[model samples]
Target: MKHNALAIALTLLLSALLGLALWWDYRRNATPHPTPGPASFPIDTRSAARPAPAPTQALPHNGLYRCDGPAGTSYQSHPCTPGSRQGDVSGGTLSTVTVPPPRPLPPPVASVETPTPKVGLIARGPRPGEGNEALCAMHERDIKRIDEAARRGQSSESQEWLREQRRWHKDEMWRLACGR
Candidate 1:
């Protein structure tokens, strides 16, 4: 009764305050920020971008090692075993390999056959043709059969039939309007 009304009022007031806070936050973020000062820019970004080179350690070394064991063949950075052959890895880092820039595509070929425009005022819809009245009556009978088939649980077939009906309706309207 009265308590319910008071609870609803408090809830509405809380909602309004929350909405006001969101509006204030949106406005604060939406306002354009001042541009950074020149002093804020990094002095030597190129040097900073380059990573420190890895330290070299002395060891029994071979650039690449390939081992042909009784099980199978394997290749790694370790020194080759007594029975296996050693070889260098091609392209140092395979991931860093670059592709040549792509050639520019040729312009589209123009269409040779251009249709000539019809002369005088154009008809708003399909032009009237002979025997269209009989065709429209046949379409109406087909539509009634389709509706019955739809009631028998053939939904997909009925939907396709309905599309055909709409097409026929358009043709019928055009035929009746132009008296053909």
Candidate 2:
């Protein structure tokens, strides 16, 4: 029982020491970062020098394609015949002749959706004399509205207008209610 306890204690100590050693090694080898100066705000590391690709003389499918015959090579759109020196070999690329890919059938067109009419819920603030309401209560109501508007991401203009309204009301409340 004593040996088992001692073994566990030793194992824990070894693990802690191993972690400490790894941390110390990392700290010792780490390169220090210098404080960025005003000039270092914008760093341009892009290499501006790169050679342009060599132009391919082969025009893609201007009714001309590479045709390889059993005897010799010829340029034609059709397959090679025994009497004629014209046959198309698929797969390998020829520099002088360009083969266009087979035309794909177009997808079916989608129908346009009819616009759904918007039903706006009218919001009317308290009357002028109701300004004696609790300061936090008014702000809480405004905050709820702003939070809901922001969550929905429906109307940024509405949020701005609410903010403006709040600002104007705050100024008025300060003057009249607070007697500032």
Candidate 3:
């Protein structure tokens, strides 16, 4: 009993030491973050170099002026330079492609004869010896869904519970004598 107590005490001490070592290692290796304070705030280096913002007032939408400058002809929304000659801008028409309307669909043909059911509920389920393909397919789908749920990692159920559910599904497949 004393030996068991001593072993337990040693295990607890080792666990505590390991935890402390891990915590210390994490703290030492972790990136240092600057504390939020007035002195620690970042300076705007571009504040002086930055250009003043344009006026928010809307410009007049008067007709565009075509200016023939000394260098080349240029288009401007406002009056050009003092020596440059300006003209009233005109016609640059864009031709649009016209799409023809779609043709109407053909009417569905009506069936005169009534359809007869071949298999019932008992026929769909598993028989004495031979297994049902539909049930086996459904089981496979359920197993895949369970695996997907496990991978998503957002389930309210524990991993153990999910594993149990998977096992249960596999057991059900065996009980149903599927894939025979």
Candidate 4:
């Protein structure tokens, strides 16, 4: 009986020592110095700094289409118009001829001369009085001369004369119409 009591006391003492040692180890590990703050973990800031790529806009008829048939045959369709099939009907090999895509047209060149305004075959505006009739007649004659010069390809002389006639007519018409 005495031997059993001594053995139990030694066992209890050993268990208490083991428990105290385990508690000390846990406390040492749990209580941290220079406690964790915001920048504790090594964060890869580059990933956050990198901008996400812009989403691609899909054009018309861009997705894949599929078709199935008898005899355990299945086929994928391409971007084609209605009733146009990429594969053969009889399961034969298809001959593909890839046409070179059309090149974009260059932008139109800007011309120095203004385009003539076309208002069908009708008198442009109200006719001037008898006193200004000669000015009107002169304006018409100048226009005819300009047209003839342009038709004959006398561009420089025609442009110069046309500019002079335009300025003269504009000034005269404004004066006659407004009684200035």
Top lDDT hit? 3
lDDT of 2: 0.62
Using TM-score as the measure, the top candidate is 3
Local accuracy of candidate 1 as per-residue lDDT tens digits, 1-180: 999999999999999999999999999999988776455655686787885432233233344444455556776666656564443343344233469999999999998965556556553544655446676666667767756755675568667877687677667656565344
Misplaced by over 4 Å in model 3 are 1-129, 155-157
Instruction: Looking at model 1, report the run of 10 residues with the lowest lDDT sum.
Output: 53-62
lDDT of 3: 0.74
After TM-score superposition, the amount by which residue 133's alpha carbon in candidate 3 deviates from its true location, in angstroms, is 1.3
Q: How far is candidate 2 from the true structure (C-alpha RMSD, Å)?
A: 26.1
> Relative to the unseen true structure, what is the C-alpha lDDT of residue 154 in candidate 2, on a scale of 0 to 100?
53
- Structure candidate 1, residue pairs in collision: none
Candidate rank order under lDDT = 3, 1, 2, 4
Off by over 4 Å in 2: 33-39, 44-180
lDDT score for residue 92 of model 4 = 44
lDDT of 4 at 123: 34
lDDT of 2 by residue, 34-63 (tens): 765555546444643654333334435545
Candidate 1 local distance difference test against the native: 0.64
Q: Quantify all predictions' global Cα lDDT against the true fold.
A: 0.64, 0.62, 0.74, 0.61
As for model 1, its CA RMSD to the true structure in angstroms is 25.1
